[model samples]
Target chain A: MTIVLEKPAPARSGPGAPPPHDDTPARGARALRALGRLSRLTLTRSVVVLALFALWELAPRWELADRTFLPPFTEVAAAWWELALDGRLWENTEASLVRSGLGFGLAVLCAVPLGLLIGWYRPLADLLNPLLELFRNTAALALLPVFILLLGIGETSKVAIVLFACTWPILLNTVSAVRTVDPTLIRLARSMDLSAPRLLQKVVLPAALPTVFTGIRLAGGTAILVLVAAEMVGAKAGLGFLINSSQYNFAIPQMYAGIITISALGLLLNQLLLWAERRLTSWRPQPRG
Target chain B: MTAKINLRAVSKAFPARGGRESVLALDGLELDIGAGEFTVVVGPSGCGKSTLLDLLGGLDRPTSGEILLDGAPVTGPGLDRGIVFQQYALLPWRTAAGNVEFGLEATGTPRRERAALAREHLELVGLGGFEDRHPHELSGGMRQRVAIARSLAYDPGVLLMDEPFAALDAQTRESLQDELLRIWERTGKTIVFITHGIDEAVYLGGRVAVLTSRPGRIKDVVPVELGEARAAHADLRSSPEFALHRRQVWQLLHEEVDRAQELEREAVAR
Candidate 1:
């Protein structure tokens, strides 16, 4: 399909230029041009992806003849269709999501209070900062064996790993958020004769929200990363486990299908977090040029 | 009439980095604000006009003397003194009414009474219809009005303003100044306003206290006598009386302004 792009608008008139027009139809035409621009961008992106898939389906057989290692795009699609129809894919997807959701929820509960305390008291923040940094630096994947030995090879160990991976981002972001709130707002609250608790509630928390939300967004991505790894270690039903099983069986098409599904899941999670961020920060003023 | 504030030999000093370098923000400052007086403090920058306001509001304690409000020594921040900052420091998440309500709720105002008080104060500031709007949604002038409303909602005995209109555009600042005068007349609360703008001090103050630079001592306390509240049609900086007071205050501040500029350059260099 052919795609048509929108034309950029002309520069504004200088001192000697014509008087501005009052035509309503011209405004509507400009809006239509913007819509046309959006659709053309979307069309170009899809066409490029489609062309790549077409090349992948025929290239190995026609050119290199590397059929043993390279799987055709149609074969990969067939493998995806089989997984979807057999009900195993749905169960595996649900397992991964459940672990990620539970772990993220736990991390939020712990990080928020710790962050508030650290952010509020300078002395406390100095004391705990080093310990937090040390803990955050230790890799989540490296501790999987310890967790499995301690909690046994069940849901707890996997969920624990996910929580550990996600908590640091939320805590650090929350502390920064609280610390960076306008000092003027704090003084205003004091001038109002707000009690200590009331001042924190009325002034401190609200001002820190936009920054705190950034941490939550980062933690969402980290949760997904940790979940996939945790699921691959000892999990029975998950996209990660499917990838591991397919690799052992030399089911190359099935491996590609599992990887594609995992990527799509991660993309969906990122979009959801972005949507929430937009909604929560609706009160913030739009930046001017 | 209420006892009003009495400052007795108040001198505030702060230590600097190299050996007890004291900044005499206020030097043996003694002044009495009569009940319901609209007093404006004017000076060059860093002359401690703001420091004086902070003392009156009980946000900062005097280093060597006393600040007595209604015959009692002022202590920590209290609801009896309301302050409006130059920056319209509104809580970002709260609606206009919510910000007003926060002040009331903090001082243990009844829950049922807060909504009514919030609405009334907002209406006084000509923002009755904008009660539900957040600070970000309003224009700069409107947000400052909301801040004024939030400050006044608690009905403090003394209103301390530290160049509250300095951040607005000229038109908006003039309009808000007019609104402030109307509010002052309506409420008849004691006001201590601090500003570097000569015209603003002359226009708003019943009396103007001009300060010298650095070791900020009060140079002169001149009565404005442009009436307690200007007539609605009176020109702000125009006419004979306004210019007369403006000239008087300028003459007193001119030399100090030069000294302040020199000090500013020295500070920047250091």
Candidate 2:
């Protein structure tokens, strides 16, 4: 919660040769300037968030937003702390994790390979085009009743719903990724007399990877979204279930706690995916200020 | 001595699309390029210069006639012929050394040897210290150097370049042209270069072949006698002999350039 302004580095250059960092003082100064700007931006953002939180806490206490509908932020925090100590939050989170993880993992495994095959073979793409168009048009939530009827109101139904929801983004993105590989690179491989499999393995796969990763990240977002919706409709344990139950029982603070947790989890997921993207596609030039 | 390459009555006809006539790009083209000689093909745009290079590179088949490389019929792209495309198609994800290693890997060269050869070729193209830098990190000229290194890594006997320096600025292009000449001298590989620039044709090639418009065929072969002067002097481009050769090639291409422009207008009109 503390923001410390960075201090200038001590002189470290020696007699014969200047220290590597000291040799590039201009670059260091530029980086420091950028860092200063970034810190300022973060400070401003945090101030706005803090102001919003203060309003949330004070407005209800002052009878401004109605305490029955919107409890003070302090009360919601206390409720969240209670859930954490009692292990209720952990238990529900564990259940949700297992369901979401299985669905996401299965979607990635199935969709990537299927997409690559479809992209490589034009006839297969043609065969699936109509089906893809249909599925793309149809929303995953629209099929909830169908899934519940087919798979029954169990873990299978919820996980299946999550999988269906997550598949399209990963699948379609991968197909486009493969198709949009640079033709020049393909020609270069062919000119070297590379075998078909070898060409795909080396040139096409690496070239398509950044786009495919984008699809997976999008799918990751949808997995949580659809799983929450499914759980809200029918589930014994999950963040969504907690929120829904809290609302029914008129525990406004607990409901707010659940929503806050979901928002925090979403931020965590986005950060994790961004870190993975940076590691995988390090060759791409980073956007400069 | 047997010719390094022979093209006999070579012709290419691209199938018409969208209600246009079938385009015969090259017709009855005949040429013989000698072993260890630098040959330049020069013509106006749409004169089937690229089609002729494609035939020689075995990337495409002639609609009729034959292309023989060292007495063997040109069948398909093979390791014996290395091609340098104009755009400097270096894989952006790979380091300069890694790009050079591609052809070596395709030839199944061992990992250690591939690394060593990649470094050697990078140095040959004056990119020794830039081994770890990716294509995007390098300038356009540097990227082309990496591309040239990649093509040369597997040691192809004949180098076929398609306007490789066309994309570079004047200074970089001239320096690279000099570097290319040095490499050609040191390696003694037969080179078939394609370009539309009269100066580039005269400066690079011992024999320059000018092609006619549309159904392209050899208009004339201008023999450049400035090979000694080119090697001896840095300012061979400013020499009288260089000017004479440039004028000869320019005059041959002037009529073809107009005809090609006319053909383009007709197509646009249609």
Candidate 3:
């Protein structure tokens, strides 16, 4: 169980340092070294992934499982290709994405300002705390029937369910973040005689942004989870609906394809949120492990 | 000249938990700081040194009596006073220059002028070429320097520094003290500094006010007779006058510290 780690090349040269030799042999040696490092970094993971795929492809053919219920990797790939060619995969993906985006956006739009207000004003927080706790504790999925009854079985109910599920994390995390801001910083701001609005703008908001982003990232994951569950209950054209329909019709290969598509979409959304978090909090010091 | 600050029978009390009797932090403290003077306050731990600075900075109010600035009563926090906190309370999200520009921005200074003034003050504090760096990127000493720059940039008449260099290394503390002396000389602003270190108080203050234990009040105000060229004299700390002043402050603080410890023990026993 030897672990090989990739280390970047040491940076020895600076502006005042002498230039390195530009001969072909030296350049060729440097290129070879970089190539070796790259392979050491990526080759092991690639081999493991390929081996897994090969095992999946071979298991069905070897009669390890019933082919109708557990089709080979190739069959799933072929079904996915067919769906893509007919535009069903793209349409379904777009539908799921739009629902999650709208629900998540609505949650952020409502929760953030409310959270800031609740966090900043103690009276408001005291008034809202018990009610918010009650609603948050009530499982979002259990409200599915109620939402459908009131909002109907169309996109509204599905999006509304997601909005309900996603709002808590963003709201609660923001409130805690604002409340826990360093008191010394607030005193410093006060010493400057900053007006109430200016204090919120210059100190409170920026101080709490990193924690607020954490809430948003959590909400993103919740939105996807709730969206998929809601779509399964009643929807025509999302990854969740695709999986449900395929399972009912005994199209195991299509069901696997739908599951993989949802996983891929979740991964992409998380990465995008992480990128935004990094850009916005560039001034924050990196935590030392 | 009229005093820059006049504290008349100032007292502060905090409500204790569980409906207990209030704890007195400061008690009928009367003092006056002349304009353009450097006044250092030294006291035992838990002597409400910070509470005193908070009142003077207008971050907190005295429960009784009045604190007058120039001829007017101190109300709330205002642009007239600038504070440098011990924790270097620079906003982590802002760059060095941005932190210095904070008070100016609050006072509604134009963006262009704020930048120019921030740059000037940062240079004054010897933080030139480090304007874009964030507080976390800089060392503790550098962060304090930036905080000083921030306080100065606001152009306040009085600078209230609450043990600004207490967290720095000994060498860093010495250099910063010298830097502060130079700045005070150049700016001629009234400075009220709080410190636990007697040496630091003696080195920096033209007048050192020694405070008593809990329910703090001024015990003695010792004048530092070290010459005007003390900042340039590297050996000032080792000079006889400096040591004498340090000992005087230590003697006053020693009794107060013992009293505070005894009070704590009795409280715990109870």
State what share of the real interface contacts each candidate retains: 0.81, 0.71, 1.00
Per-residue lDDT tens digits of candidate 1, residues A100-191? 89999899899977898799889999999999999889987898899999998889988898898889998998898889989888887776
lDDT of 3 by residue, A1-289 (tens): 1234334444448978754554645665666777777677688758998897788888889998788887899999999999889999999999999999999999999998889889999999999999889988998999999999999999999889888888999999989999999999999988888877887878998999999999999999888888888889999989999999999998899999998888888888898998898889989876631
lDDT per residue as tens, model 2, A194-280: 887887788877898899999989988888888888889989999889989989999888899988988888778878988888788
Q: Give the higher-TM-score candidate: 1 or 2.
A: 2
DockQ agreement of candidate 3 with the native complex: 0.87
Chain B TM-score of all predictions, in order? 0.95, 0.97, 0.97
Cα lDDT for residue B256, candidate 1: 98
Off by over 4 Å in 2: A1-38, B19-21
Scored by CA lDDT, what does every candidate get? 0.85, 0.89, 0.90
Tell me the DockQ of each model, to 2 decimals. 0.57, 0.72, 0.87
TM-score per candidate, chains pooled = 0.88, 0.92, 0.93
Worst window of 10 by summed lDDT in candidate 2 chain B? B227-236
Q: Rank the candidates by DockQ, best first.
A: 3, 2, 1
The residue ranges of model 1 lying beyond 4 angstroms of the native Cα positions read: A1-38, A41-70, A286-289, B18-20, B109-112, B228-233, B268-270
Candidate 3 lDDT tens digits, B73-164: 99999999999999999999999999999988878899999999999999999999999999989999999999999999979999999999
